[model samples]
Target: MSDTISLVVAGGGTAGHISPMLAIADAVKDEIPGAEITAIGSPGGLETKLVPEAGYRLELIPKAPMPRSINLDLFKFPLRFIKAVNGAKRVLKESNAQALLGVGGYVCTPAYIAAKKLGVPIFVHEANSKAGMANKVGAKTAVAVGTTFANTGLPGEEQVGMPMRSNVAQMDRAALREEARAFFGVSDQNPLLLVTGGSSGAQSINTAVAQSLGLLADAGVNVVHITGRGKQIMDASGQLLAHERYHQVEYVDRMEYAYAAADLMICRSGAGTVCELEVAGTPSVLVPLPIGNGEQKLNARELVAAGGAVLVDDKAFTKDYIAGHVAPLLADQHKLEEMSRAAAALGRRDAAQNMARKIIAEISSRSTSGQEG
Candidate 1:
C-alpha cells in the first residue's frame, strides 16, 4: 500500500475555528511530507476566504444553523442539512479522504455524517471547555477527540492543547519584539497597548478603546489597535497619527508583530486568541465575549486560574475599568515581565506538531486497512 494519507477537515465559521484548522493542516503536511488535506466550509463564511488564502483547498458546503432552542428558523434546518450532507459526501468521495476531523460548528455536522456513512474514521477537535452541539453529536462515533481545554466531554479525549500557526509558533520572541516595534514605528522608550476585539472586532471593546484614546495616549501608551474592517466605532476617538504614537488598523495581517510590539493586550477571550497570547508570552487583560453560554469566559478562567491572564467582565469594560485594569499593569514593568513569563510558560508550543502527527497516524492506519482489503 502507498504511504500517502488523505484527510478532510470540516468546520469553520469564525477565526476561532478556521485558524486552528489551518494550523493542523499545516502540521499534517509538515509531519507526513505528502499528506493531502481538504477543508470543508460554508461559501460565505470566513473559512471560504481564509482557507484558500492559507493555501489549502476548500470544499464549500451548503449549511444553516440549527437553533439550540425553539426558533422560527428551525423549520428550515432539515432541508438545509440534507443539502449540506450531500455536498459533504461529494467532496469526501472526490478527494478520496480516509478520515474527517470535525472542528465543531453547524457546518461540521454534514461532513461528520458523510464520513460516518462512508465508514471513514472520524476525529474531533473541540476548542472550547464546553462542547458545541456539533461535536457533542459526533462524539458517540468519533474514534478520538482532541481538546484545547482539559475537560471537554468526549469518551476517549486527549488534551492536545491548541495549535498555533507555524509562523506564530516558530517565532523568536526577542527578535520579534524588535521587529514588531519597528513595524508599528514605536521605539523601546514608549510602551505599546495592543487592543483587538476578535477578528471582526467587538463593538463594546472598539467603542471603549476609541473613547479612551486620549487617556491611552496621555498615559504614554502608543496604541496598536486592530479595529476590524467596516466596524462603525473603529475611529470614534480620533484619527490615527502615524509616527507619533497611535497605530490603528482595520485588521492585523502580521500577528507576530502585534504580539512582539505590545506591552499589554486588552482583548476578547476566544480559544485561539488566548493560545496565541500564551504562545507569544504576551500578557493580556481578557474580556470574555458576553454572548452565548459563557464559553469564552470559561476559557479565560483557565488562563486566570494558571495566573497567566487577568479577566475583566464584559459589563465592567468601560474606559475607567480599561484604564484601571490595563494602565496599572503597563505602568509596572515588573508585573508585566512576570505575567509575560507565566503566559509563555502556559503555552504548549509543540501542540501543532503533536496533533498533526496523531491525525496522520490515524489516516495512515485507515489507508493501510483499505489497501489490504
Candidate 2:
C-alpha cells in the first residue's frame, strides 16, 4: 500500500542459495507485479552471473568467508567483514529496502546486520536441516525464521519448506510424462535415470557413473547425464562417450523436463535437490557431499526416512554400489512408484507463495500501524 515493496535478497555463492533466493523474488513479484528486489552476493560467488541472468540487479560485496582455524586470512577477516557490512548498509539505504529476505550464506551475515541497523524488517529462510552460522546469528532478531526442515533449532523456526522454482514446485509429472520422456528420447516402457553432480559436477559421482554405464545400458535404463560444465564423461580417445541409451549434457536449462522424464535419479543431496526431488516425486539415490558441516546428510534425512531416497556416503557410492543397488532399484518399477508418492507428499509447492505472503503481510502491518499511530 505504501508505493511499491522494496526488498533486499541476501545470499548466493552456489545454486543451493541462489535458486531459493530467486524463487522468493519470483513469488514476491508475482504478488505485487512491480516489487523492487535487489540481490546481494559476494563478487566471486555464482550469484554474480545468475542474479543478473535472472533479470534482477546484483550488488556485490567483499567476500567474507569465515575461517575455521587460525590462519593468515583470520587476521584480515575483521576488516573485510566491516567493509562488507558497510557496503550492505549502502545498498539498503539506496534501495530504501522495507524488508530484507535472506537465504543463509556468508553474504547474508553482513546484510543481516546492515538491515537491523536501519530498522528494516529481516526475514530469513534456512534451507538446511542444520542451520548455517550466518543464519543462526540473523535469526536471533529476525522478524521470522522460515525453515525447510523441522529441527534446525533456530529461534522462531517455522517449517515453511523451500522456496523453489514455480516450474518445479507446480510440475504435474503425470500430465507431462509422455512429452517429457519423448523430449529426452526415452521410451515409456524403459526405465530412465537422471544423473547429475550439480553445476560444477562431482568427480566421485562422475567416475562411479562412468564405470556403471555398461551395466545401466544392459539393464535397459536410459540415462540423461548432466556432467556439470566441462565434466563430461569421455572415452579413451578423449572424445565424449557414446552410447545409444545414454544422453550426456554439460547442463540442463530446463530441469522440469529432466525431472518429469526421469523415473529415478542419482545425485548429491543438497537441500535444494532434495526438495526438488520431493516436488517432482522422483525417487533417488542421494550421495551427500563429503565435506561441509554434514548439513547435506541432514538435509536428506526426512526424505530418506520417508522412503523417498536412499542415502550413500560419497566414498561408498562406487561402481559396485551402482551395480548392486541402483541397477536393481531401477528394475523394480513398483518400488520406484511407491517412493515417488512418498517424496511427493513431502514437497510443499506453496513455499514461495507462502513466504511471499508473509513478507508482504509484514510490510502491510507496518504501514497499518504507522497510519493508526
Candidate 3:
C-alpha cells in the first residue's frame, strides 16, 4: 500500500449528517498523514459552509431530493439525479479517490452510485436507527456498513456507534463542571438544566420550557435554554420573577461548556444530540419530534431503553408536564446519578477512530489486491 490514501466523504443538509462526516474525516487525516480527503455536498446544503470551515475541500453536486408523491419534481428527478451522479464522478476522477465513505444524505446517493460505477470501494455509516433512503440503497453494494444503533436492518450492518467530536466524546463533566457552570453564570450548589432544540430550535420545546421557567426557578434549578437562531422566548407569566435563574439564548457556540454545566438535559432526540449526551454521561428528558418518519423516536429508543433518559410525548411536553414529571426528576439526586451511569455505559468513546480504521483497511485491502493482480 502507498503511504497515503485518497477518500471522498458524502453527507450534508443537516448538522446530524455533517458532524459525523467531519469527525471521521478528522480521524482519517490523523491516522494517515498526507491523506487526501474531499467532501461532496449539494451547493445549497449546510456542508457548503461547514465543510470549508472545518478545513476540507468541498465539491458541489445538484440537490436531487427523492420525491415520495407523483408530481412534476418526480418526473424531473431522473435528469437531476443523473447530473448529480456525473458531478460526483467528475470529483472522484479529479481527486483519484480510492474509496468513498457515505454518512447518509442527499449527497450520499449520487456519490455512492458514482463510486460504484467507477469501481471505487464504498463504505456506509448510518447515524440514525432508522436508515435514511440514501444509506439504505448504498448499503446493498457497499463493502461494509456501520450504524449508530444495532439492528438497523440495513445490509451488512455493524454497530459502530455515532462518530462524535473528539472533545465532546472525551469530555469529563466533573473536571470542567465548575468552570462551565460559572461561564453560564450558574451557581455551584444549584442543579443545572440545559434545554436545546438544535440549530433552528423546535417551537414545541421552546414554548414548553419558556412556560415552565418560573416553576423550574421555584424548584431552585438553574436553566440554560438555547432557543436557536432568531428564536425569542419570553417567560409565560405576566411578571418575570427570579429571572436570574432562567437564562435564555439564541444559540450556544461552545456546547462542550453547556454539556459540562448541565446536570440534566431537556432536548429533542436527534441522533447527534443523543450520542453527545451519552458520551458526556448526561441524563436527559428526550422529547422526540412528532413528525416525519418517526426517526427521532427511533434515535431515542436505545438510550431510553437503557434507563439513561426519560421519553415524553411531544404533545404532553408542556408546563404541566414539567411541573409533574421533570420537577421531581430534578429533585432526585440519586436517580440522576444512576441515569448518568447508564448513559456513560452506553457511550462509545472511540467511534470516529473505529470507523476511520475500517475505511483505511478497506482501501488498503483493495490496493493490495490490485497490485497482486
Candidate 4:
C-alpha cells in the first residue's frame, strides 16, 4: 500500500448537500494532511464550480434521481443508475480509493455501490431529520453513519451534528456584531432582519418581505434581503428597491456576515440553515418549505421545541404575519436575548473536527490492521 490513503467524498445537486460535503472534505484534509482527496458529484450541480474552487480534483457522474411513480423516466432509471455506477467505479479504481465519504444526494447511490464493490470503507453523513432516498439506502450497508439530528431514521447513526463551515461553527456573534453590521451597511442600534430563500430564492418569502418592509422599517428594524439569483425585489417600475435601512443582494458570498449581523431570520428550515442558526445562535422565524416529504418541518422541530425558534406555515407567512409576529419579536430585546441563548445551547462548535477525527481514526485502524495481516 502507498504511504497516502486515497478518499472520495460524494454529494451534490444543491447547496444544502454541497456545503456540508465541502466542510467535511476540509476537515478530512486537516485530519490527514497526507491523504489524497478526490470528490464525486453530478455534472450540472453546484459542485462543478465549488469543488474545484476549493482546490480538490472532482469526478463527474450522471444524476440518477429515484423515480417516484410509474413513468417513462422510471423505465430509464435502471440504465442511468448503471451508467453512474460505472462512472463512479472508474473514478474510485483509478484513484485506488481506500475509503468513501458521502453526504446524501443523487450521486451518492452510485458512489455507494462502487465503493462497496471495491471493498472501500464507507462513511455517510445525513444532514436532514429524515433520510433521503439515497441515504436511506446508503446507510443500510455503510460501515459508519453520521447525522445532524437525533432519530434521523438512518440505521446506526451517530449524532455528530452537521459538519459546517468553520466560520459558522466558530462564529462569535456578540463579538462579530459590529463588524457584521458594518459589512451589511446596517446600524448596530437597530435590530436586523434577514430574509433568504437559498440560491434560487423563494417567491413567497420575497413577496412577504417586500410587502412588510414598511412595517419593519416603522418598527425600527433594518433588513438584509437575499433574493436568490435573479430574484431581487423590484418596484412597479421594475427597479430594485432602495431604502437606507433595506439592503438588497441577490447573493452573498460571506453569509457569516449576514448571520452575525441579524437579530432574526425568516427563511426555510433546511438542515443546513437550522444548524447554522444554532451555531450562530441567531433567533429565527422558520418558514419550512412546503414540499419535500415535510423534512424541513422535521428539521425545525427540535429548535422550536427548545424555544430557540418559531415556525410559520408557508401560506401564513405573509405581511400580516410579519407585522403580528416578527415585528413584536424584534421589539422585545429580552425575548430575543433569551431565544439567542437557547439557540446557542444546542450548537455543536466542534462538529467538523469531531467527524474529521473519527474518519482518520477509522481509516488509520483499517490500514494498520491490513498491514498486520
Candidate 5:
C-alpha cells in the first residue's frame, strides 16, 4: 500500500454529480499539494468527458443501469453488480486510495460495496434535499455522510452543503458582470436573461422560451439560451434579433461567465445551478425538473422561502405564463436587487473547502491509527 493521500470519487449520471466530484478534487489538491484524485464512471456517462477535461485521471468502470421494467436485463444485475465491485476493488488497490467517496448514483454501488468489504473508510456526499436510492443504500455504511440539505434522512449525516466550483466561491458581482457581458458580447442597456436546464438542456423550457422569444425581445430583454444539442430551437424569430443581443449555445464551458452576464436567470432548479446562483448573487425564476421523486422541487423550496426565486410548476410553464412572470421582473430594478441580495445570502460558498477539511482530518486520523495506504 502506498502512503500517498489518494481518493477515488465514484459515481456519475449528470453534471450535478460529476461537477461536485471535480470540486472536491480541486479542494483536496488546494489543501494537500500531494493529494491525488481519480474518478470512476461508466463508459458513456457525462463523467467520461467531464472528469478528464477537469484535469483528473478517470478510470472507466463497467456498471449497468437498473432497468425500470421486468426485462431479461434484470438477470444481469447480479453478475454486473459483482463485476462492478471487483472492478472497484482493482481501482482501490491500484491507486492506493485511502478512502472511497461515493457521490451518489448507480455507479456508486461498486466503490461503496468494495470499501465495506475491504474495511476502508467510505464518505458520501448527497447533493439533493432528499436522498437518492444509491445514497440511501450507501448511507448505512458511510463513515461520514455530507449533504446539501439539513434534514437528510440518513442518521449521522452532516449537512455539509453542496460542493461548488472555485469560481463560484470567488465570484464578485461588479467585476464578474463587466467581464461576462464583454465575454458574451452583450450590451449593458438590454436586460440579459440567462436560460439553461443543466448540461443536457431542458426541452420544455427551451420550447416555451422559443415560443416567447418575440415577447421577450419586445420587452427589451436580451436572451442567452443554452439549449442542449438534441433539443433544437433555432428559428426565424430568435435569428431575427441582432446577433449581439442574443446568444444561443448547446453547452456553456464557463458557467461563471454566463451567470455574470445575466440580469436575471430562468432555469431548472438543479442543485449545482441553484448553488451557483446563490454564489453569483443572481436572481432566478426556477422551473424545477419534474423527475426523481420531486428532488428539484425540494431544492427550489428553500430558495423560494428565502425570497431568492420564484418557483413555477412545470405544468404552468406555458409561453404566455413565462412571459407574463418574467416581463415585470426584467422591468423592475428594485425587485431584482432584493432577489439578488437574497440569493447571495442563501449560497454556501465554502462548501467545497469545508468538505475537504473534514475529509483530510478523517484520513489523517485513520492514518495515525495505522490504517495508512
Candidate 6:
C-alpha cells in the first residue's frame, strides 16, 4: 500500500446516508494517514452543509431521483442521469480515486456507474434490512457488499453493521450518565426518557408525548424531548410549557449527551437512530414512520426481535398507549436493565473500523492486480 490513498465516497440526502459515509471516511483516515477523501452529493441536499462541515471537500452533481410514476420527469431522466454520471466521472478522474465506496442514496447511482465505466473497484454498504433502490443497483456489480442487518437479500452481502460516529462508538454510557443528566437539568437518580423523531420531527410522536407529559412526569421519569426544528409543542392555551422534569427543546446539538442520559428512548426508527440506540445500549420504544416503502418498519424488526426494543405502529402511538405501555415500563427497572443488556450485546462497537479495513483491503487488492497486469 502507498503512503496515501484516494477514495470517493458517494451518499447523501439525509443524515442516515451522510452520517455513515462520514464515519467510514473518518475510519479510513485513522487507518491510513494522509488519505485523500472526497464526498459526492446532490447540489442542494443536506450533504452540501454537513459534508463540508465535517471537513471534507464536497463535489456536487445534479440529482436524478427515480420518478415513481409516468410523468414528464421520467422522459427527461436519461439526460439528467447521463449528466450526473459524466459529472461523477470527472470527479473520479480529477481526484484519481482508487475505489468508490457508496453508502446508498440518489447520488450513489451515478457514482457507481462512473466507477464501472472507469474500471475502478466499487464497494457498497446498505444500512437498512431491505436494500434501497440505489444500493440494489450498485450491488449487482459491486466488488463487495456490506449490510447493517443480516439476510438483506443482496448477493454476497456481509453483515458488517452500521458505521457510527467515534463518540457514539466509544461512548461509556454509565460513566457519563451523571454529567449528562445534569447537563439536561434532570436528576441523576431518575430514569430518563429521550423522545425524538429525527431532524424533521414526526407530528404523531410530538402530539402523543406533549399530551402525556404530565403522566410521564408523575411516573418519576425525566423527559428530554427534542421536538425537531420548527415543530411546536403547546398546552391548551397554545403556550409552550416548561416543566421541571419535562424538558422540551427544538433540537439537540450534541446527541451523545442525550444518549448518555437516556435510560429509554421513544422515537421513530430510522436506520441511523436504531443503530445509534443499540450501540449506545439505550432501550427504546420505536414508532416507525408510516411512509416511504415501509423502510423504517423493516429497520426496527431485528432490534424488536432481539428484545432490545419494542415496536408500535404510528397510529397506535397515542397518549393512551404511552400511558398504558410506556408508563409501566418506566416503573420496571429490572425490565429496562434486561433490554439494555440485549441492545448492548447486539451492538458491533467496531463497525467503522471493520468497514474501513474491508475497503482498504479491496483497494490493496485492486492495486496489486493493476501492477501485475
lDDT of 4 by residue, 1-373 (tens): 3446688999998888888888988887776677788999997888999999989999998888889899999999999999999999999999888788899899999999998888888889999988888888788888889899999889999998889988888888989999998988875688899999987899999999999888888888999999999998888888888866799999988878878999998899999999999999999999999987999999999999999999999999999999999999999999999999999889887767776767777788988898899
- The residue ranges of model 1 lying beyond 4 angstroms of the native Cα positions read 1-3, 68-73, 232-244, 370-373
TM-score of 1: 0.92
Stretches off by above 4 angstroms in model 6 are: 236-238, 371-373
* Number of clashing pairs per prediction, in order: 0, 0, 0, 0, 1, 0
Clash list (residue pairs), candidate 5: 2-373
lDDT of 1: 0.82
What TM-score would every model get versus the actual structure? 0.92, 0.97, 0.96, 0.97, 0.93, 0.97
How many residue pairs in model 1 have overlapping backbones?
0
Report the Cα lDDT for candidate 4. Answer: 0.88
Put down candidate 6 lDDT per residue, 228-302, tens digits, no spaces. 998968777889867658998888868889888988899888888888888888999999999888989989988
Per-candidate local distance difference test: 0.82, 0.91, 0.90, 0.88, 0.83, 0.90
In candidate 3, what are the lDDT values of residues 1-373, reduced to their tens digit?
A: 5779999999999999999999999999989978999999997889988999999999999999889899999999999999999999999999999989999989999999999999998989999988989998899999989899988899999998999878898899889899889888876678899999989998999888878887898899999888889776653573332365887778886788888898899999999999988888899999998998998999999899999999999999999999999989999999999999999899898889998999899888888888899
Question: Cα deviation in Å at residue 75, candidate 6?
Answer: 1.5
Best-to-worst lDDT order:
2, 3, 6, 4, 5, 1
Best model number under lDDT: 2
Query: Which residue pairs collide in model 2, if any?
Result: none
Instruction: For model 5, state the Cα shift of residue 44 in Å.
Output: 1.2
Q: Tens digits of per-residue lDDT for model 1 on 93-206? A: 998888888888878888888889988888888888888888887877988788888887777888888877878888777778877888876776678899998668888887
Q: Candidate 5, residues 1-373: lDDT per residue as tens digits?
A: 2245898888797888988888888998888877888888888888888888889888877876777888899988888888888888888889888887888887897778888888778888989888887888788988888898778697678887789888777888768787788877676667899888877888888888877877887888888988876665655775432333567778778888988888899899988888888888899999998876888898888788888899998778889886678977899999999999998987888788887777788888888778544
